[model samples]
Target: MKKLILPILLTICVIAISCQQKEKQNSIPKMVNSDGSYETVPLEKDTLVLKLIQNSVRNVKKIENAKEVVNENLQKVKNLVVEACTTGDKPNIVLMHEFPLTGYLYGGRKDKVQMALQIPGEETSELCALAKQYDTYIIFGSYAIDPEWPDHILSLTTVIGRDGEILKKIWKPRNIKRFYSSFEITTTTVESVREKFIEKYGIEEELPVLRTEYGNIALSTVQLDPFIFSAFTMKGAEIILRTSTLFFESDIIYTAMANNVYSAMANIPADSPYGGNSMVVAPSGKVMARLDKTTEGVLEAKIPIAKFRENRKLPQYAIELTKDIFKQYQEEIPANHLDMPKEKLPQNGKEMKVLLDSLSTWLNQ
Candidate 1:
């Protein structure tokens, strides 16, 4: 009888432990699967005017009146938001170019980190208030610093809803490093800090699609990356909101047409070197509204979002056909290359390239 009692108690303990483990697993956010179908997205209105703002960033680093310069830039964004909401055909969403708050500064990690702002900080709060007043969604890109991730600068796209609350904070998916001969982006990206990022935010947050009454939106500053955008579409993204310092107009057309989704790009003004050509496009590669040239202004277009979402289905990827090839191919650089000790972090673009090269399987091969 004594032996039987001991075995029964042990069995009960095992069952309790298993239940706890299952609960923890269930607590995780639903993993976005391309192979699965999601519920139809809802819309607040039938037509929405998407205003893509072509503006310039105001650099305030190493200046005597940094606070004033930052305030002026913030005010510029607020003015644009007010104008878009009050303009002839008021916009449902206002988009801005990357670095509109703190423009790109040519410097090391430390210098740029100093210029990065915190999400939900003072600047975003002001934008949120404007969003509430205008009843319009506001989205923009900025270089941000987070206390959770020390010594790392982040490229971010913040989405504000009509309720004046931050709906989503989208991080740049990945940065293109191979194109430049002597330089590479030194900021923290999903690809750069993959392991730690997933650990903290979960894999679902890596390629999150912000589902709002306006539309199922996905925002990023990454350009020339079809795979990343395609993944977002598969995860039920109906619209792609892109922000960038410079213009890559052709890629926008390609992404929209191929994915069969509405796409918009907001680039800095022509006054800034290599800037301009901000535009909005439809799925059929039709240009909705475009800047004739690189200039500072707003490009607006009306999208029949309700009609567009009626029969929309997830992108039909030929995954089974290409599975073997994808599995066999070796990526140039493995992820988590920059997930090192803070003291060992790369300081600039050149150093970043060296670190990536050393970790490249192909380079070593």
Candidate 2:
């Protein structure tokens, strides 16, 4: 009876979320987008453990054998996965921080493109092997390139499913580019190439929610963007998985509480002045498990998914009330500014700043 009811409830939950989106649309969503959500297989068990890797950051700019370094980083990750998954209770999901393989390379678009790895290339093949070996989901953020979007460097969080399949490729939603005075983030994101992205992948892919057997997980690299995070939750994300190079502890906690979803942030653990803590937070904004700042390790946490979903539903933000203000609001710099020809793309942070200034509505005004 319990088994039967759980399946029914899962179906109802998916419908409830899909129906809410359908209510807003006049026509049915395309087959590519599915019934307004990218659905996955049913839950395998009630309890799920997540292991967040707070690993060391190593930039490959100076390394001569960058290819070897990529494999070396992967080997380190393999060891970590073997260490964590084999000992004690195995984790259902293993998460890694931003730039684990190639790390942060300084350059213009050409250099960045040269440094980035292809998503389905030799590297992800190795990641798929691990996911298949352990029968778990393996997710990590990397600097990637796509043959479809030639010469463009991408900040992508890739999800590998249980059967060694590339489940979803989550592009960094938007970069906090204007904040820094000296330079700009040159990575191509959803906002950077909004028109082209929408034309190719559809709008739903902009803030995609991956419905998985473990839970409704949304992969992201966006930070300090309340609108982006809330929108994901409203799209039915039960758990938000994030990768970061920096820390804003308040940003993680507040977003979880306000959005009403479990949030886990995996950050780089380095012996430096800029080390941030990797943590998992509850909907109540309580820290469930965390690694000490600058520590190299896996921060493990358990989620009782079945119990958490008993009365859970998608969050309903006051969208109608604030829709008018949002419509009126204008951002300082216009998007698609970076969506230029490959040769014309800004090469470095300084060059990006110069290009952005000319395209900035605020500065020009």
Candidate 3:
């Protein structure tokens, strides 16, 4: 009777321990949303880790050497990807600065045409191979020669998926023209610009968002306009990647906080006057990781998608500003100011300044 009783007690202890362990494993943290609804905290699968490489831009004068430069930069990027992967968990996405492979062209049409490579051409093929090798989505910028217009070049941001497929290509809308003596400035009218985008991409919108497994990502170039950021957030963008030749600025941080989305900027290593300081900002506007201004390095961060969504639900200044004003002026404000008619715009820089001054005076009144 004593032996049977001891065995029964041991069995009960074993069953109790098993139940406790199962409960612990199944339990998850919970948080209350602003709407008074409860939700389980997101697990590892709900987060996206990203690595943004701030590579040095090597300017190659000869078009023939472009492949070599691309190969060299790719090697550096691959090494960084490997390094990031080896450290604990691997990154879901890898991003490179503008012109990471093919350096940005500052010369005339001849130079641009010489430097521009075809989309899905040799460079992107190699990049796609790397993306498949790492099993990570990669985003990189380059100057691409428009197949339809051999004489023209477009600044392109190419996104390669984990399966080695080219997912999307975004052309830079706001192109900066430098009045250099050596290069001829093509006077592009507002109507021509609108026609060019509609003819090429079939979309009138300047900022286009790409829906992905990780989050809704939007790509942009050097120009960091608050309105553009707001537009993306309004359209349900969760992550904003700005590939630029310019340095990371405070605007990126502010945009992240205002929109309650993860914002990242990848820039060259001070090779040009505008390039330097790559950075990543959290949904709360905190700097997660940053590469030094002069160094060629990678910035990695884990973005909590669930938490970011929750942050978006919180009251934000940008959202407040749009409460009544946005709907009222939605039709009045042009999507792209450059798309506006020339007759409504100031004729010259002087006239533009005068008009701005007059508006400022009226606003002050």
Per-residue accuracy of model 1 over 232-253 as CA lDDT, tens digit each: 8887888898998786778999
* TM-score winner: 1
lDDT of 2 at 1: 84
Candidate 2 residues 1-365, lDDT tens each?
A: 88899899999999998998778564535423323333345677898899998888557674366787788888888888777778767889999988888888765677677778888889889889989999888999999989888887899999999899998899998899778989988888999999899889988899998877788888899888998888787677888999988777788899889988899999897555446689999999999988887788777899987787766665656868999998998897787887777788877889889998988888898
- CA lDDT of 158 in candidate 1? 92
Give me candidate 3's TM-score against the actual structure. Answer: 0.69
Rank the candidate models, highest TM-score first.
1, 2, 3
Worst 10 residues of 3 by lDDT: 183-192
Which model, 2 or 3, shows the larger lDDT?
Answer: 2
* For every candidate, C-alpha RMSD to the true structure in Å: 6.0, 12.0, 20.5
Off by over 4 Å in 1: 1-36, 63-65, 271-274
List lDDT for all candidates, in order: 0.84, 0.83, 0.68
Among all windows of 10 consecutive residues in model 2, the one with the lowest summed lDDT is 30-39
**TM-score of every model versus the real structure:** 0.88, 0.87, 0.69
Question: In terms of TM-score, how similar is model 1 to the real structure?
Answer: 0.88
lDDT computed for candidate 3 = 0.68
